[model samples]
Target: MAARRPVDDTTPHGTTPHGTGYGALLRTPHAWTFLLPALVARLPYAMLSLGIVLLVHDTTGSYGLAGAVAAAAAVSQALVGPQTGRLADRHGQAAVLVPTVVVHACAVAALIVLAHSGAPDWTLFLAAAPAGAAVPQVGAMVRARWVHRLAERPALLNTAFAFESVTDEFTFVIGPMLATGTATLVNPSAGLAAEAALTLLGGLAFAARRDTAPAPTGPAAPGVRRASALASPGVRLLAVAFLGLGTVFGTLQVSITAFAEDAGSGGLSGLVYGLFATGSMVAGVLYGLVPWRSSARRRMVVCYALLVLGCSTLWAMPNLAALTVAGLFCGLAIAPTLITGFTLVETLVAAGAKTEAFTWLTGSIGLGLALGSTAAGQLIDRSGAPLGFTVALAGSGLGLVALVTMRRLLLAPAPAHRTVARGGAVREEAAPAARRG
Candidate 1:
């Protein structure tokens, strides 16, 4: 049966509707047209950090320089992403994506050229900035489209958010393998080159599928009180929490590598990382399946507390096997925390600002990862791998503090406004962000 788009905005934040599965979300018309390309575009994001590190390291032969270049790009992306999302809201996604994709491809080419030419280190920063900035926010845009499609069906939206998080973790698990494998089997530059190619092709394909894109929301009307997505207190809180979440990711990658190397099992780093992602993937699938009674506001705090608890043991693990087990435990809390955060987003901001709001969280993660990696590297250089794990634990602990103290912010009402469909048609109703499950 085809999924119906009724007015279910009154439904609470948790997944309460029993029969709506991810299949139901996909069974509708034109779903695959936009979805597959979005997934394709997003894969490069997971690849870029590693790919850039590999290529730059090959050229510079200095891990410090290579990591610095990658960090510059990630920070550049984090700063520019929400701006792109806001522009997409004012104009159409396709209008913004065409130029963004073109710039991204050119920038990547320039970065590769600079690295191979042994240009001054400053030159790499120049190319890396725009390459990261112009990388399209396909993941956030796709989520906005999902909001436009299922604004009335909150249960299905819950499943959709869960599915997207799982897809993200899937890419994270696969992207590093593809990048490192290509560099090993082919050439160092090949990994980043493949990443650029995917962005160019998949971004264009996604942009061309304009029929499914969220309609351009030109400006907020007089009745709409919010001036920006970040104006919402809840949105800001989630962004902060997600920034902490990113540190876990950034810290783990470097720390795990150090751990494995210390134990004479350096080859197992990828396997350990994959094990962590697998735990999140399994948890995400199960999270979407269960119908819950708690509101999303309460859920965020609980899930984050669990994440913090899981991270507390990372600094104390005695060996590679123990560290991997600790990572797996920490991973189990990740997807659920992310799923709840995005769900809260759907209810926290008005339709006009959906994409921008989502980008804020996504970009925060990027920022956290860059900062966390730098911090962990410094700590490990001064001390050891065990000290490096403290970065993840400390970051998450700070977020938990906010989650517990300022959770009332999560209950702020979702600003009221209907989503404008293509050709200026209104397609949704006002929704309250602070509702019970």
Candidate 2:
């Protein structure tokens, strides 16, 4: 398919003939219409994850089993992400999202029953699998819409992604606290039910928006699969970066929990995670505000350097307080890296493949986190929490290495253009940096 040209926003009614750019992008009737669901959908994920260990422990009376159940859900999501994305692409996001929400609701209901009914461990695991499979692709779909709406405004697009990443940190921080606290106060099973209700509400809210729909694609020619959207080299490299980052995130979460247990302050794990999230949230807002004349590649290199320094500090810290400080530093880099990388991917990917590309990206993150979290859990069990932290730091280093090696292939120049002003005047303005993988 031919590349879609950016729409000129200078037109007299603030919209272009091709219907592209920031003005057109934000022209939708309700901006929060998209943001609300995106924000709400995060609640279920946060609650489900935070409550998983507690619920499973209550049901099975095994920490090992609880951790395993968590891993099972992560793996299931990873396995199905691409398939689900493909379906969303072939049909539409609603076709996949609506049904998935129902499945998720049913699955949540079943798991609650299984947890309460003294069901066998195997049955509980089996019942949980389908629910994991039903998670809606809200993150992916919202991003796809961003691409579709902001096709002409790359900078705004980048800022939007940065906002999304920040929101994710905020959601996780609050979601887990709410989930764990509610479960402790009310009942473990109630947490899961609450997540079910949130998922339905958030997923439906996002689906209800016209802007949230997938962009129209080129008619499928012979021998084309919907998954082909993510086949580009740029998207694939972004996926690799996502995989590395996801592993780092996943391993860090498990290690922090283990560390809390080892320090005889298991109760403080959620608090520390909250601190980490707070730091990231603060950094995210600042990231958008910082003025930088350098290229995105430069920004990426700087961000990675900060991340490496922060991750390495974990090994140097000797106490929980120091570790929390280190986590804060590391957290600060999370949104910047993700925002820059995803924005770059959005620019490079084919217009028609936006949803699929994002799905692959999201899937890479889910898979990496799954593998990292599970592996970290096992390592923590065997060696200890510090060793797990060391392992996590090593993963971050590897990600930095990967980013450096691929730097040349990944950094595409930002688009620049000169325009002829009316009355025979001439003017030149640089387009937002052209994103390339």
Error of 1 at 86 (Å): 0.7
Count of backbone collisions within predicted model 1 = 0
The candidate that wins on lDDT is 1
lDDT of each: 0.81, 0.69
lDDT of 1 by residue, 1-437 (tens): 12324222323444466656888988857989998998888888877877776787678765456666777777888899999999898788999998998999899989999999989999998998898899899989988888888866767888888889998888777777777678777887888899999999999999999998888977556565446788778899999999999888878776776677679875566678777887888899899887766677788888999999998999999999998898888899999999989988777776778899899999988888777777876687669889988999999999899889988777744345555566867577554443211
Which 10-residue window of candidate 1 scores lowest in summed lDDT? 1-10
lDDT of 2 by residue, 1-437 (tens): 12334321222112222422334345654666787887898667756655666687667765456656666766677678767876776667776788899988898788889878988888777877777778777787877776665555554665567677778788768876676666667887877888889999988877777665654453466764434645566667777777777776676767776687678876677677777778878888777554344556556767876777777777566788988988887888877887767766665555666677777777777767666766776777777777666656666677788777776655432345655467887676654432211
Best prediction by TM-score: 1
TM-score of each: 0.87, 0.82
**Model 2 local distance difference test score:** 0.69
Question: Over 4 Å off in model 2, which ranges?
Answer: 1-29, 61-63, 116-118, 222-227, 315-317, 411-437
Residue 17: error of model 2 in Å? Answer: 23
> Model 1: what TM-score?
0.87
lDDT of 2 at 206: 78
After superposition, the stretches of candidate 1 with alpha carbons farther than 4 Å from their true spots are: 1-16, 219-226, 261-267, 414-437
